[model samples]
Target chain A: MPEKSKSSPQAIGYLYGRRTRIFSLLGLGIILILIIGIATSIGSVPIPLGTTAGILVDKLPFVEITPTWQDATATIVLDIRLPRIILAGLVGAALAVAGATYQGLFRNPLADPYLIGVAQGASLGAVIGFLLPAAWNLSGMGVIPVFAFIGAIAATVVVYFLSRVGKTLPVTTLILAGVALSALLGSIVSYLVISSGSKLHSIVFWMMGSFSGSAWSEVFLVLPYIAVGIAVIVIFARLLNVMQLDEEQAQQLGVNVEKFKIILLAAATLITAASVAFVGTIGFVGIIIPHAVRLIWGADHRFLLPLSILTGAIFMILTDLVSRTVLAPTEIPIGVITAICGAPFFLYLLRRRKRAIF
Target chain B: MIELEMRNVTLGYDHHPVMEDVTFKASPGEVVGLIGPNGSGKSTIIRALSHLIRRKSGVITVGGRDIEKIKRQELACLLGVVPQLPLLPSTFTAFEIVLMGRNPHLGLFEAESRRDFEITRQAMARTGTGKLANRHVNELSGGEIQCLLIARVLVQETQAILLDEPTANLDIGRQEDILDLIKNLCRENNLTVLAAIHDLNLAAQYCDRLILINDKHIHAQGTPAEVITNANISRVYGAENCVFTHPVNGLPTVLLSALKKKEIGRNTISQR
Candidate 1:
């Protein structure tokens, strides 16, 4: 009889644990749909929430749409809102996924997509593109993004090599080196901003981050990278968990640690480069979203990586909506909104999981 | 009967040799303890044998197959290890941590099978950690965490186990518990165990044979009673100690030789 009671508690505990995981995933899914719908409904001319869903349904294959092609509702949904919403979702997912990958690759919870100074480097390049006299003529020609992508790659490479003193790169020292590089690059970017006084506003806006400039072209450009990056991360997720043990253990477990590190870091860097090229330096999404997901879901990378992507997409769309509608005609930079939202959450996470901060 | 053999093995880092000409063998159902003074290359020997670090020149063979010829996973399947003060990833639950033992068995891109879970569960039960299955490993006490690590190795289901100071950091009770667990597991499973133990008495009590290392060389190798002697202890460890038998088990034990009574200081007398 006593044994039965003891086993009963064990069985009940197992069931409860499984139930919570399911509930969390279901909750994230529901929030994602709601955020996408609400974000699509927001803008200068607010569309009804129902119309947003109807528009999405109309675009789906098997749904019969009797609405005329020339209808104002159809045009607003298909041409404008659809692309913007899709862009927001993709960028958010990309940033979040990139953040998760970097965190795992570094094996540091505090690490994010911005850890290797990629975002700062990309921001510097964007500033250079904006401040240059030729930028006025080169605007909308994809020059800014090209420069930004190059800057990100260069900065990450520098961080990578500088951190490798010999055969072994201690994680703490690597982080410190990355922080130093970020500061140096940041100062150089600030100098560029000050030197080009007339173009300072444009440069600052780009640095602050924004999705206001997102168009179908930028979205399409980033989509391939995001898809590829996510696929690479998903494929390597279990291998990353293996690496959480010492390198020797990971090797014994059939992971090529050096090869995996190179591939994972490259994929993460590619995602960040593609993302910042289009949306500027949107802070907090990449860093905070993955950690938040981890806090709730635990560290099964199989679940954490995909969940982070979904949550990140939803988070960005919601933040972008707030950025656009907060001040009717003039939009606040999406970076500002994300920072203002993310800093508090970061502090809360740090406070709640003080031991995990390190 | 020799399952694993290391012959004239040399190991070091970056062309600098730490230990050389180290040779040993552990046959099936035998417990061999490697005992040495600090820096005598006990860990270096284990690392070389496990292929965690490369050996400069030696022939290491498992089941008549050369160690170098075996793939990493295949080797892992042949031997499981319990490292000294293993640093574990904190985020995983006890079950998840144990389930990783199946990595050698898992196909790339394939999930763990139900059989894997059953094995993990049985390991946890054997280690008396089934109650903590759902708990995060980071939250466990040192003793509990050590058991979970042992459980992980058990789930690996290797024919041999290599333990490096597995109980070095535990309290006396926990150390005894872990040692007993390892001894029983090896006995029941007929496992070949090569353990690096610092406590000479514990090694004397449990090991079927002892290999004493001093200055990167084997000082003595035989039964505990044969290898652990006043002459060998004073020579190898540079310590003056007396040998005695355990009261219950009648195993050889050591006591440090005391100085003459006249040499005792007046301050020591006053303190006593």
Candidate 2:
């Protein structure tokens, strides 16, 4: 074929240019590090920035510095604050990426990590684990998360199969099925919570969501699941971009829509189930973080996923800090803080754009 | 030369068969138009050929290889489809949407290379969509989106192209421009083109062979002059005295008119 003569139309450049994207990524990275440092220093005890850095460095292998800070300060920073911060970051990043993936897969801006009954299912399982005799709890690797993961995958599978009409998976039907199943599972969880005689307070606390007792063990437990899930999602980021089009169009473009959907749903659900298993259901991070990223940067998943990870970590760290210090001796539930901070900002963004953010 | 052939193919959703025992062949360097009424399964045929929907029985082959046996990427490399109405993400730029056509050519982990960008850009230029590259798909007009879809198909660079109502939303000038582009591409690249067109005149003008479908089967298949006769149009389309040859090309065209009172009265009497 003969080449068509090109008449330039005064190039408008990319909507999100490469240079701007890279710079935003680097800037967010630096900001995240700074926020972590600042956040570690500002908790209830109010450790000095220098002392915090010294404690962190001292813990690093082969770089042992003399303990300049009090032993109590070291214990508080290393044993409590660090683990809580890291777990909060992991859970936030996991939820945000999972939310983004769900949004892209369903082609609905309203889609969140819990859209397909994962939360209710995990809650039901966790409640069951809580009610069980303390004998079932494995050493450090609690039985609740394992049951939650199983419950989450099973509920999603059920919803997926129920909503499928022949080979087509209609988004509306899927959402309806998820809602129905979620209500059913939620009732079961409530019933379980009511019947629990002595575990009521702890169960309710877990349900309300907290990182109060988060330990390095819980952090280590969630790290692999979130890391692996995020890696898989990032690998398929471009395909996820193509999937923003209707399923038939994606299929015509050589995407095995059904297979891709299954893989993505599994990965997103796994990370979400893992995150919620320990931290309870932290709301708003899944929905608000992705929307905020899309509002500032475009909806391209290549950028959306990584940007969500960074911003989600930062947002969670900041929110956790507020939850710790806002009421001082009485820390608020992190869920309450996220919703309080996230919902208003999200509404502001939606009103400002007044256009389709997806 | 690649040929798209569907032999004894039956397609439908669930248990209800829409088109049964359909057989046809679109050869290289030829344009075949599927002309039918609104519900005559024209789009179903296109979908089945693209493997967007499965055929119940028989086989669809591209370049003498069964489409079912071909992997999705390989099938996409062989055939490109422009859906009648495609839902695109509103936020995506035309450039990004067009660049996605290169997906079939790339490996699973491979991002678009410089060469792929060049090809996509060249396609946009050819289809006159370069000016719209930076614009969001949601902001584009219907004709602009149609042109972008065509540009995307061009970027695919397949051996066979399937289009469902390729010019459904275009004005007269753009309709001709798009058809002319497809024709030129067919001739130059030796690509087989199969398009489902509602406009009888346009089908007759552009298609080397026209397949008229009625009542879930192929009613007639031949050159425009042979297949689009007055008797065939009246019998299949239930329109009497509408067929006429185009003055410019001497190809068959249909002239439509409002239903007369006498015809309505006669039809009422017949019903009674």
Candidate 3:
């Protein structure tokens, strides 16, 4: 490479751009809280802010709200809002962390959980459940998540081994392998759906992503996977940062790059699989939320991973609210709302990053 | 004390050996230059020493401990390497890039301490890159990024530093600056430096000992004056060059013999 002229503009002073990022994150957090409070309050039956607060306060272990307000808000808040908010938060965080880790692990900003075949596999599993008469009997409506989780894990393993041709797992080859595998899994899912003529509607609706079936029991089921995944990623943040360098350099620097890669892959697969199991396949949340956080917080996985978790939670809660209200009584799929919101933002980023390689 | 020693070492890709029975020692407070033509196994020597690639046979010792017996983190604490081309993504700052040197000292969930920050700062200061500390590493000029990579090794604070063609892509001024910086670091800190240098003149200028490699063997090994003679240059590199003392530094240097293209072309044409 020839030396550039000294008179050219230098890429310094980029650190000062943090102020806007800090303010934006704060603003986003506030908006998240407002959306959760307001959206949850305006459901099939409207609950006033006063009543919502009363129900919320009463649920706290130590809080004692006034009798009248608690009675008015109890069923709406406890039976509906609490589960929905918790589910939204968990799903959002799960998707976001998965996105950030994938981006860092692959050393490509555009990589997401869905890009590596997790979503496709989960969708396939959901379709499989839809086809089986046993699964449809509602005797095993509860088993959908289990099937989806297993499918996701299987997809991740296939992609990983397909990319591992002997000692080196070149980034380009891995990404190409992922795309191919995703297409294969996607076709299988479509075939299953098409074959189940009567059950096609259920499969299609689930693929679109929804929170309509979320309940307190489902929330508990998904919580442990998301929590464990988040903990594992946070603990391994520093190791993930080291992995951005070439594998030889990273190994020489004392990182067990192969082991770390496996750990990250397993954690990311667990979270995405679990989140998609019950919530259906939510598009854009995994790809969009992490990118928004990274653009705000820089790419040190230590901070980026945690911040993405929070930002993801916020983004999902708000998007779910929009899905619920956009078509009153109709309850639009959350996936539809996220795609409509995320696609334009993604395009804007793509345009800005025309020359910027991550 | 011997900081690094390779004895009867053999290296290869998988099962086939590329180089055999190589022996060398880098004692504390000396800089050893590994010089050779392209594909002469210079980079392989660095890789084998750093444990980036497995050795086919023989023993490597660091600080009197067998390299194979040392754990990865333990080996890292004693040695560090600066690759020919350091990779940096657009998102990493110079400070963060240097901080990665602390990996050997950190636990799985550890955060950077004040001591770690101080060491990173000192490294930046030593490499004359403190002003660029917060700047994105990938956006910097090649020379600037090379300096930052050296700074990262400095932060590692290892007793031995291995460099593979560190100045290969640098301009003349930057090359001189980097070589001088490396010499100063070795002298001041008692660092055992083994650098694979492409420029023979630069190696002759800074290295206390030169090991000439060709055709997967040590062609010659001696002081610069003994190893950099015209006979050696012609035999090893197939270049018709005159050996002379550098006018200012009084060091052995090579001056290529003149050969007009028409004269060489006509000779080859006649022979054919």
RMSD of each: 3.5, 3.1, 4.4
Candidate 1 per-residue lDDT, tens place, A1-358, comes to 0012233232234346556877777888888888877777777877787777777778789997665334676667667776777888888888899888878877787788888889888978888777666836555645788889888988988888888756555566667877899999999998888998788888888877777756677778889998998899898887877778767777655565666787888898898888888778888899888888887666778778888888898888888888888897898898888888777876786578754421
What local lDDT does model 3 show for residue A52? 75
Go through the candidates in order and give each one's C-alpha lDDT: 0.79, 0.88, 0.80
Quote each prediction's TM-score: 0.90, 0.94, 0.90
Give candidate 2 misplaced runs (Cα > 4 Å).
A1-12, A57-67, A164-169, B257-272
Query: Which residue pairs come into collision in candidate 1?
Result: none
DockQ of each: 0.42, 0.52, 0.38
What's the interface RMS deviation of candidate 1? 4.9
Q: What is the lDDT of residue B125 in candidate 2?
A: 87
lDDT of 2 by residue, A301-348 (tens): 989999999999999988888898899888888889999998898788
Better of 1 and 3 by TM-score: 3
Total clashing pairs for each candidate: 0, 0, 0
Task: Report the CAPRI category for model 2.
Answer: medium
Error of 2 at A42 (Å): 2.2
Q: Which docking category, incorrect, acceptable, medium or high, applies to candidate 1?
A: acceptable
The residue-level lDDT of candidate 2 at B29 comes to 100
